[model samples]
Structures are given as structure tokens and as C-alpha cells.
Target: MRYLVAALLLASLPVFAQTVAKPMNDPKTDTFLRQFAETRRFMSGRPTKPRITPDEKTVLFLRAQPTSATQTLFAFDVATGETKELLTPEILLRGAEETLTVEEQARRERMRVSAKGFTGYDLSDDGQRILVSLSGKLYVFERATGKVLELKTGPGVIDPHFSPDGKQVAYVRGHDVYRLELATNTEKRVTQGGTEAKTHGLAEFVAQEEMRRYSGFWWSPEAKHLAYTESDTTGVEKLTIVDVMRPERGGNTFPYPRPGKANAVVRLGIIPIAGGKTVWVDWDAKKYPYVATVTWKKGGPLTVLVQNRTQTEQQLLSVDAATGKTRLLLTEKDDAWLNLDQDFPRWLEDGSGFLWYTERNGGPEVELRKPDGSLAQSWVKPAAGFFGLARYVDADRTLYFYGDPNPTQSYLWRVRDGGAPEKLSTGTQGPAHEQFAHVAKSGGLSVATTQTATTMPRFVVLRSDGTRVGELPSVAVEPPFAPNAQFFQVGKEGFHASVLRPRNAKPGVKLPVVIKVYAGPTTTVVRHSMAENLLNQWMADKGFLVVKFDGRGTPLRTAAWERTVKYDFATATLDDQIAALKALAEKVPEVDLARVGIEGWSFGGYMAALAVLKRPDFFKAAVSGAPVVDWLDYDTHYTERYLGLPQEHPEAYEKSSLLTYAKDESKPMRPLLLIHGTADDNVYFFHTLKLSDALFRAGKPHDLLPLSGLTHMVPDPLVTQRQYEWVLGYFQKHL
Candidate 1:
């Protein structure tokens, strides 16, 4: 009996061993994983540029290849899952021949010898034509027959916009707005072009970046008038950008208004659509720092949102269309900075009133007001979550909007006809993002739905009542790259951290950890979504555990969490991050305390640089890109929000400045990599340039990579690739 029992135990022991010894690269598992990775890469490849179609029946999107070398336009039916390819590189090159003359073709051939091929284009309002600019000249393509029409046979014609009536196209040529009548086949200048001395109908550097505004003009709904802003830079200081690569050509000095410096004087004007004299609107000439938001009302007044120089106070003014008389409707003031909404304002059917978004009561909410400025109703009350822009307001008076009810995720909510709001969909644990397209006649909504963490983004059509009508076809599945990634709560403050582990990580393996952080008031890094950040993945693949946390001061969370770091922005946010990290290091044994690196860009970059300077014992290395080393160095609109005015709180600015905390000659800190573009007008290249000198004076060893001609966003691919390589090399050497 004893011998028989031993035999049974031995058999069970072998079965247990087989179950424990799992293969690392099982064929079925690897195939599924590869497919999952491919799916993610494919979705990432989908062009995220805003899609706007004429009839609103289809969405015109740009699709790019995996390598991002080839891109084409695709039309996706909003109602159906059907998709049709509209343009490709080969097709565009073939169509270019029909549009260009022999000499013009030869010129483009010469230019293409070194230039990257064209990729972006805009479709006409009727959806039957597309205006594509390749090599330089604008070419109009007939979508049905694939024929081409040469609109402007010239050297420079950029950013073309179709007229509302679809009979003409307007573009920027030589810094002036130019109109090209498609029917008459004639070109006319809308404004006198700007030279070295003057700039007309085009935005300057500060306005474009800090204000989050671009272009100089907007076409009226009737297509008979063009409303534009003219910026006079006669008084603004000029910052010269020297091009060392082509020293013989010399450099250009642009009107760059540094902090506390004089900015351009701006004013609004309306011009005849055909071409005529300009009519300056009724503006307060004393208000030199006026910013305007012009929107055309159906048959009534034109709403213009105006702000003062300091950007602390904003007023919504309705202007009489014919008389040009302005009347102030509503006013909003913020102790820090008033938020601006660039989206199209919602107007009622009768044109008697409209909806406005304000944070007057602490949280961003909606308010309905009459044309005379009196409050009609409270459309949305202040809540814990932030109220996003209203997507659609139905005739039944139910307002549909997108907002993060919880800091970690966003959901669609519908406020009944002047009633309380209700969550629409089944709330997911992770982040959920919904983008809507308005149904033309019925005012219904179509959405591109995506749930993060486990599910992929899919398109869905929803009824007015928020019921799903149908689901569009899902994209091919990609391999699981960051399956271990999960959002962990940091406490009741709604603070959370996104944690990702190495793919082949084993229990008890002490791996180096990297924290990609952005502790800012306007942007949040951690959210519920399937989108994989390339930088985070690269670090994880190299055996480093990557984590991203949205501490206090980050936006999209509760008002308290966002405003907690108000006066002491960097200090409070960094302390929260370090506290979270220490807690994580103690709880997760896989995290190695001896090896920790921090990285970020812009505001995040500011925090990253501060992390190593303030907490060198916790952070080993830091990589900062275009960081605002000093709060006073940044623009008024963004910096003032958290730190308040420099005069109001000088100590806060001094403490937050990275330069102020530079190590003494004997007391040094961790290795730091400081990167900036030579022509970064947004944060100013002087930020890193000044910091480099400060670090040198302090005898701290650091590496500096100054990219030439790169802007704040770093749009150049070569520069971006170098940035990635530098970040990886820094972590590899130190972390």
C-alpha cells in the first residue's frame, strides 16, 4: 500500500513541474502578441489631424504607413464602416503631371531631388474636389475622375481654405491672404503683403504659441465678408535668429516679445469677400492687448470674445452686424488667468442667446445667457469634474458634452432639457475618449469611441438619447506590448499613477525605474487609453520599469487637486511625485531605488530638471527639453496661472526657477541633459542657454543639445529622433 501511494505522488509531482515550466516564446502566444503590437502600431499610424468634411456625411482623414514615409487621404463613411482611399503618393505624383506645365514640372523635379514628398491636403466643400500642394504649387484634383487643375502656378501657396459657397479658395501667399476664384480661374490679393517692416493678416510667434491661436482671418458664413485680425509689430522687440548652417545668407530677426516686453498692437477688421476696403470694428483703442474671438450668428449679431492685456478679465460682446455697435453681454474674471475656448460657440436656433463656459464658481461649467447679457439658465452646474466643450445641443434642450467625471477617465454625459446631468454610457474602469460628429439635419451625433487599458478604439453611432445604434468595424489587433500597465490610485485626491513593467520581468528582479512626469496645470500625462507612448515603451523594452504620475497641479482632475499647487507649482507637485515614488518603491519590490531617472518636455521638462535639483537623493538622472528654468522667463498667459504675477509673489518664482537652485561649487547634483531649439520662440532658446551658463558657473557637469531652427513642438523628425536617442543614452549610462 505504501509503494502504490508513492507512485501516485511521483506522478502528480511531474504534472506540477510541467505546469510551472512555461515557454517564453510559445508560437501561439507570440503570434497573438505580435498581432496585438501590430494593431497598436497601426492605430497610432492613423493620422490624428482634425478631420472636417463638407457634407458632414463622411470624414476625410489622413492615413500613413507604418514607417511614416508614405501618407494618403482616406474617406470614411460616418454612418457605415465603409472606407475608400482618396489619394496616395503615387496617385498624387501622377495627378501632379496633369496639373503642371512642362517648365513647372521640371522645377518640381529639381526640388524633389532633396525635399521630402508632400503628404497633407484639404478637400473642397462639395467633397468632389481636393486642393493639394506639392513641392510648392497648389493642384486641384477632381475626386470622381482623378483629374487635376492647377490653381496657383507659383513658388509659394500654403494653407488653403475653401470658401463656404465652394466656388473659391483662399490661401496665404507672401504673408498676405489671397483669394483664388475657382470658377473665374483668377487670383486676387486680399491684403497688402507684409515685408521686413510690416505684417498684415498673419499671426506672430507669441500669439501663435502662447495664445494657442493661428491664422489671421476667418470667412463669414455668407462668404461675402472676411473677418481678420491685424497685428502691428512696430513697437515689439526683435530677437534675431542666426542661421550658422548658411552663414552667407545671414539670419532673420523676428518681432519676439519676451516676458515683460512690449507685444504687438492688435485690432479686428472686416473686409469684403470679393476684395474691398476694411472696416475696423468698435474696439477700445486703449486696450492694446485685445484678443478677439469672432463668430457669425445666423441672422443676428456677431459674437466677439475680447480680453484685456493682462488676460485676467474676459468679456463677451455682441456686435450689431450692419451698425457695428458693440454691447457687452457677460463678463468673467479669474484671479489667475481666464481660459479661452477656440471652438465654435453654440448659438440658439432663434439667435436670441448662446452658451458660455466659465470657471467662475471654481469648476468649469456652462451657462445660458440672453443676448442682452442676463443669465437665462444654468445649463451646467459646477461639479467635481471639469466640463469640456459642448459637443451637441439637441432641440429637446438636452446638452451633450464630454468631461472626466473621474480624474482617470472621461465619459459622455447628457443634461436633460434644463435638468440635472446623467452619465450616458456604461462607465469603464480605464480612460474612455469619445469624439463626436454632428448629424446635419436631425442634430444627432456620431462618435469615435475608444476605451483604454483593455479595449481598443472603435467607431460607433449613437442616437439622441445616447443609445448605440451600431458599431463600426474594428481595426486589426496588435500584440500586447504593455499588458502589465495599470493605473494605481494615489489616495482620495484623485491622484493616480500609470505603472508599466518590463515584458520579461520576473518576480524579485530589481530593475531600474524611469518616471516620465508632467506636473502642470493645463495638461495631464496619465489617462485611461490604449495609446502607447513610444518613449515609455522604449525604456520598458530596455528592462527599465516606466511610470507616469499626474500629481497635484495637473489639469482634468478635481479642482482641488489641480489648484493645490497654485502658488507653489513646482515644489508641491514634485513633492507629491516623490512621495508617490517612495510609496511605490517600498510597495513594489521590483523597483530599484539606487537607479531612478526622470524625464519630461516643456512644463514637464521644468519639473524633471527641478526633480534632480531638489531631490538628488531620490532621482539619479534627469532629461529636460525646452524647460522654463525660470517662471519670469515664460509668457504671461501660461506662467501667471500657477505662480501668479512675478511682482505679486517674487519668492515663489525664485524657488521654482531651476537656475536659482544651482549647486554650489563644492555641492554638486546628479547628471542632467538640457536640450532646446535655437529658435524656440515659445519658451525661448535663452532658457537653456542661460541655464547652461548657470550650471557651468556652479561647476555641474551636464550635456546640452541645441537644435537649430526647431520650434517649441520640435516638428522636425531628425531632431525628434536625436532627442529620443539622447534620452535613451542618458538612462542607459546612469539609470
Candidate 2:
């Protein structure tokens, strides 16, 4: 009954609003957008993929080249504190332009990697040779000689990993897995019978996008065998993406399963690197169709985590290396659905036991379990927090972890065997907000990154005694304007929210408000990192107070907080946004609740559309980008997990659909602007078009703008700059 009657009734409805606004010339806005091009990235100087050598003599990381959006590999000498460039993308490619395959492009999209050159690499066990892929060709760089050798491998090769002994490399090509002998320069096909409809050693669409399981293969400890996934996607539905601007290029069709549709059938198998018979792991595929995680560590049995169709039940099974026989080691069942942790089910150095994280006590806690699946000890006591273990220091009998006691704030801590956990990061400088620390098991050396809403991320090396060794140089050009975000916990639920005021606003003046949100399941909006809110800060500077909060449905908190949206996705997510807004507005005098707006993309887009259509009194104007109008059009794993099967729980789908509200002629018609890319395959472009069709049938008015070739992600800097300007003008004109 919330949106039964809108503020702009049928009689008061105005003419269709303009879809495009004139570009405004603002110095501050121009400066902010220019940073994206000048820095080559929003937050430049960020050291990525920092790995300590086994000898602890050097640390290897990737840094952006100042002139171009490409990464160069650099090695930092631990003893001298001097950094030296090992390989530059220009020298490695020999000035040849890099060409990516379709598979590579999709992987980059899922990872949100817009930069180029040496995105990832793997070092050998002895740290002698580093294996990397450039433009679908394999390359090996010798650390001692500082020489790069590009092998004559064919195109479309991806995810090449060096064997444990560093004698061979395993990679995927044309849906099949292959092994290359480094000594003789001989190549052997490890697994055969792969087609376009089915693939081996490659993750399915849902696994990479939703489940966060990027790699589809696991290597055994002795380097003699490999475990990989074979996904048969023939059963899944197909969605076509067309480049309407070029009619000659018809469309590309791919298997994209919708809600209540068949998902790709996945099977796990064990293969020998020496070319032998394939051993398929046995499991109840009908009951558990989703493979969530796989782990194969030295001296331990191969383990896999599988979940049911509804994701309500998960089984952790141990696979025999030789026979591929599976035995259920542990099983977890929840009334709603199981949530996956980033780091869990990790084996100890001795391989006698492992660490398992569970929410049986209402929040996530670490528990040590023996290989026989018996409880050993409570490694980390039950607390209202989420924990992700970074490394286990077997010598000191301690495990280093990063967790958040409060959902919005994060810190690093160490938990010893039979001892209470001790906090290591105090955030003394400002707020430990989003701090991450990684410890090296060999040398007792660690690295930590600290950042806040007003602070740029900085990396520092630390000794075992928590003494700072030296800070690594960051090439990031910090923004000229100081961020004005104030963190607060509001309402009876203690919802975490950040409010950003206009940089030049006076203390007594109130400004119009905008709520930018992605109130989807398992996504958080309230993080301590400054980079997470740069766009919001820029929006705040445009004479609007920006507010973002993590509602009941999002993750990073207790299990109970997330369970509020079970079978009720629309109600809890929308209600919490409204409650947090009203509570924060009452507490802060700068928030003008009378003139409010909402904007978001993807899940946030859905929430934006839902806000105006359902609660017009609160959200006067909205801009929805690639919104999911109907639950029936969404994918299987994500939608069915939260709302249940469409057939079994039809009411849940009806309650979550925006089409129902659009067809209701009595409901108010607010100023809604819909934006989508015609080539958005993840959330298809038809979602907005279908909703527009419904509005037209109801004789309602709205605005629609479609980008020509953009996908679900806005990778082009110009496109992102224009998008912000368009949104700013729309809000200014409407609010």
C-alpha cells in the first residue's frame, strides 16, 4: 500500500521529459573527469598482485605506466628498499598491438580490468621463472637473466599456469586443456572432445560473474595430475547481443540461462599431465548442480564445494586423486540459502586439519576441523563480524586475517592457537576503514594497505614485530578537492551510511539529496575506501548531498541481517532505504528530504526504478540504468536463490516485478529516466524496453536512452564522463 497513490496523479502528469541534456561546462567537474585520463586510472600508483619471494629477498608487483593504461612488472628489493622495472609492456610486446580473443575480453569484463598489459602472472615454486600471457601468447621471463622469451603458441590461449616443478605449463585453448613441455618445446593435448557448446577448464558464466569462482581448474601438489571442470552449456538458454549500429554484423549468441531455466551442467574430473584416462568425480548432479569452490593443496585430498539448485544446501566433498571417488566431508544447510566466503576450507601446513567458517552462531566464525571432519577447536571465537584469513604462520602458531567487527569498518588481526585474537591495525592515522594486511609464511614479513573516505590508499611494509620497514612509492595523483563524507550509523537497526556534503556549501544551507545505491544481495555500499565513493563525491560537489548505505539485504554483516530479504527481495531492500534516509535526514540538517532523487545501475538500477514507482513521495526523480524490470528475465542462480522458483513461489516473482506497478494506471507518474546499452548481455537491454512497453500500454510517459555499443560495464572514460554529466543535469532540472 505504500505507492497506492503517487504525488503526480494522472490529471497532473506533464509532457514527456527530455531524454538528453545540454553539456554543462563546470571547472570542478572537468577536473574530476580529466583525472581519469591523466592518471590512466582513478586511483593510480596502486601496487597490484604483491607477492613475496620464497627467500623474502624481493617483492613483485604490477604498477601502471604513467603515459599509457598498461601495467609494467616491477621488483622491489627488500634489503635495499630500491625498486627496479623488470619487464615493460612495450618491450614485451615489441611495439605490436595486443589483440584479445572473445574469451579474454569476457574474463576482463568480469574482473572489471580496463587497463592493458601483464594483468596477471604466476611464479614458479623456486621463483626462477615467471609465466605470463600477452595477447593470447605465452611468455616466460627468467628472473636471473632478466630475459623474456615468447613461445610460438597459437592464439586464444588463456590462463597458463606453471607446474609445481616448473618444467611444464598447462593452459586452455579452443575449449580444451593442453600442456606444453618447456624442455623439448613439445605440446600435448591433455583433454579432448571440446566444442563451442561445451568447454573444459573454463568457468561458466554464473560461476565467474555471480559465484566469484574465476578459475575452473586446480593443479595437484606433485604436478602429476590436474583437476578441471567440464561445463555442458547446451541445455542453457541463449541470448543474442546485436550491434545495431552495424547491421551487417548480425549478432552473437551465447548461452545465458534465465530464471527457472536450465543452467549449464557442470562435472568435475581428474586428468593426468602425462596424458592418461580421465577420472570423473561422482556426485548427485540433480540435487547439487552448482560447484562453488575447489581446493587442491599439497599433502591433502582434493576438495570441492557443491550446492543445490536453490542454494539452500551445500556439500563439501573429498575426491580421491586416483579414482575420483567423492565422500562428503561436511554439509551445510540454511533455511534460506548458503552464502560463500572468500577464504575458507583452507588446509593447515601440516595437512592434518583445516579451517572452516560457518554462521551457525548467527555470525561468521572460524572453526578448526580435523581431516576426519571432527571439530578440533574454535580458532576464532564467535563474534558479530566476517573474517577472511590471509595466511597461516605455522612457526608462530598464529593465523593472520582481515575482518570487520562493524560492517562498515575493517581491520587486520592475528589469532593464535588456543589464544584470543589480537587486533594489529589500529587505524591510528585516520580510520582503519578498509585496511588489508598479508603476511609471508617464510620470512615473517607483511604488507598492509590503509585508506579512508578522505585518504588515498597507501601501502607499507612491516616486520613481524609490527615495525614499518618502508612505504612503497605510489604514483597516484591525489585529487585536488578534499572529500566531505561523514560516516554515521542511523535508525534502530544501526544502518551504516555515509553522507557527502557539497564542498562549498555553507553550514546553515540545506541542499537537495540524492541516494546512490546498489541494494542488491551480497553487495555493500558502505566501505571505508575512498576510491569506492569518488563518483559520489563528484556528484556531491554539484550542489547535491549524496547519501549511500548498506541496507538489510546486502552482505558483509551477520547472517540474520541478510536473511531479512528471504522470499521478500523488494520489500526489505526498499523499506530499509526509506528508513535510513528519513533517519539520517532527521539527524543531519543538511539533507533536504523534500527534494530527493535516486540513481543506480544494474541492481541499483532496479532499486532506483522500484523506489519511484513504489514510493513516489520519497523519491521524486530516478535514473535507472539497465534495470531488471521482470524477475522472469533474470538469471537462474541469483534470482531463484533469493525469491525461490518462479513456479513454486509465483507471488514472490509478482511482488518483485516492476511491470505490475507500471500497469497500474492509478499510481503516480514521477519523472523517470531509463538508460541502457543495447549490447548489455548480462542484464539484457530488453528489460528496460519491456518496461517502457508496459508504460506505453498504460498511457504513461518516460524517457529512454540507449547507448550504441556499451556493455554492462562503462569502460570508456568519455562514456563515463558524459554519463555523469547527463545524470547531473537531469537531477538539476527535475529536483
What lDDT would each prediction earn against the true structure?
A: 0.64, 0.80
lDDT of 1 at 84: 77
Candidate with maximal TM-score: 2
What lDDT score is found at residue 631 in candidate 2?
85
Tens-digit lDDT track for model 2 on 222-322? 88998999999998988887776675888888798887889999999999987678899998878999988898986468999999989999998889878
Q: Estimate each model's TM-score.
A: 0.82, 0.95
Q: Clashes in model 2: which pairs? A: none
- After TM-score superposition, the amount by which residue 555's alpha carbon in candidate 1 deviates from its true location, in angstroms, is 1.1
Checking candidate 1 for backbone clashes, the offending pairs are 33-479, 35-478, 35-479, 36-478, 36-479, 37-478, 37-479, 39-478, 431-528
Kindly list the per-residue Cα lDDT of model 1 for residues 1-735, writing each as its tens digit: 232233224223111000111223343533432333333343634443334354556655555554343446666676675777766656656745424332233222222211224445666656788777765567777867977787753456655677767778777666567788887778888876455345556655555655556556767767877767777878877766554345576766667654455667776777786667777778564652556466764534667777776666877777655556778887777665666766535677676677777767767777787768788887777773544654544456666676665666666677765578776663345456554333323345444455665555555555556666554443333434544566787644435788777777897799988889888877777766655454465457667889888887776654555777766866778888887776776667898878989988888888888888877888998888889887777765566656666777788788788888774454457888777766555677778766766776676767666676665655455555545655776777777
The lDDT of model 2 is 0.80
